[model samples]
Target: MTRSVRRTRRILQVTGVSAAALLALSACSSSDSDSSASASASGKLSGDVTVFAAASLKESFTTLGKEFEKQHPGTKVTFSFGGSDSLAASITGGAPADVFASASPKTMKIVTDAKDNATEPATFVRNQLEIATLPGNPDKVASLKDLTNSDLKVVLCDRTVPCGAAAQKALDASKLKLTPVSYEEDVKSALNKVVLKEADAAVVYKTDVKAAGEKVEGVEFPESADAVNDYPITLLKESKNPETAKAFMALVQSAEGQKVLNESGFLNP
Candidate 1:
């Protein structure tokens, strides 16, 4: 071959190899850019997630909220804990909340029926009723039947509340009737009545008694099994921060969240 032809061929070969290298580099750069964009979109989470939860879940949910905030920096978890039915009413009435965790399915229905929930609620735990008595059992309250004594200053949650409804169910299940001295709006208030020594005993959740620590003594009865309440949680339809809300819900249903709840005396759903 001629020297000029050989030199031209050599240049053409180098040019082709360089073109191939450039194409490969460009493809890699494009792939990396797409991946980085995806990671940025899905991995970055930040905002305030307001949770409306039942009064009975205050302890466990608070711990989970703190854990959620810790896991995602630049995020805040604020909770409104109250009666489940009341909270449901607030949600349906256009309350700005990211999540709702109710103490019972019946109360959860209030929100679901109103189409205020973004997704169907899932039961996360179950709670049983327990008698909260004065420290050291001054009244010697032992069983559900013992609360029937007319002399006893017994406080109960209002029938509209989950705890109150559960208590009534247990009372009915045992075929016994007892009038309460007073009815409170929520489980916490009912339990507080006993803690403050205003009532000799209160029919509240086992979790409430556990949360009360040494302030009150918990008495469990067989009838509680018949009226165990199921706790359900869901995302609200009007949440402005849906992503953060969902992440918090995922944390609640995660193993780590369940551990906190189980430690707080909640039964697995």
Candidate 2:
């Protein structure tokens, strides 16, 4: 073969190789860009968000969870709703969670004190005590003093829970003490005692009574003014998705969030 012809053939071969390399590089860049765009557009917040809330907030918070899921689309919210103290204990014990919403500042302090919180918690709501009785309030219990009636059976929250602690404070403020047949672990349990007709009355949060919705009659006692509980919310330090957690909390503080809480009878904190 002629030298010029051989040189032309070599040039063609090099040109083909260069074209192939450029095409491969372009394809890889396009694929990477497409993947990143998909991830961002969907915000594909893919992970579990664990929430620890007070028992009294169970119903309302569950509703809020549904709304949150509807808004986030792909995120999952797992809730551990129970006594505020119990929830706090779990969070402090290294349980995995993204958020902590407590019924009492004291319980929230437990998490903050242990340095389990990622940020300063904000008080989102407040609740006051109420006298919850059977649907008809058959005992005709009217005032805090009425609870002293020997014929009336009353249930109270255990001292460890927020509602119980508030009950004690209300009683102390009234300078009245009466023995309760049962000390429940949480407000719902105390409310249950009344719901089941096992007790004549129970000292529970006003929100709880409202949540009960005619299952029990809520009577506002003057003494309850002295014992108010502040609800606090915070993001956890060990959260796997801090950004999404923060966003969820922001939603809770938003107007929509406040609306849900207020509808549940929680006072703005």
Score each candidate by Cα lDDT.
0.93, 0.88
Model 2 RMSD in Å is 2.2
lDDT of 2 by residue, 92-133 (tens): 888888999988889888999895365789998899999999
Q: Candidate 1 on 1-269: residue-level lDDT in tens?
A: 99999999999999999999999999999999999999878878899999999999999999999988888999999999999989999999889999999999999999988854658999989999999999999888889899999889999999999999999999999999989999999999999998899999999998999999999999999999999999999998889999999999999999999999998889999
Poorly placed runs, candidate 2 (over 4 Å): 1-8, 11-15, 34-38, 41-44
Output the worst ten-in-a-row residue range by lDDT, candidate 2.
42-51
* TM per candidate: 0.86, 0.92
Provide the lDDT at 93 for model 1.
Answer: 88
lDDT of 2 at 145: 82
Candidate 1 regions exceeding 4 Å error are: 1-39
- The positional error of residue 178 in candidate 1, measured at the CA in angstroms, is 1.2
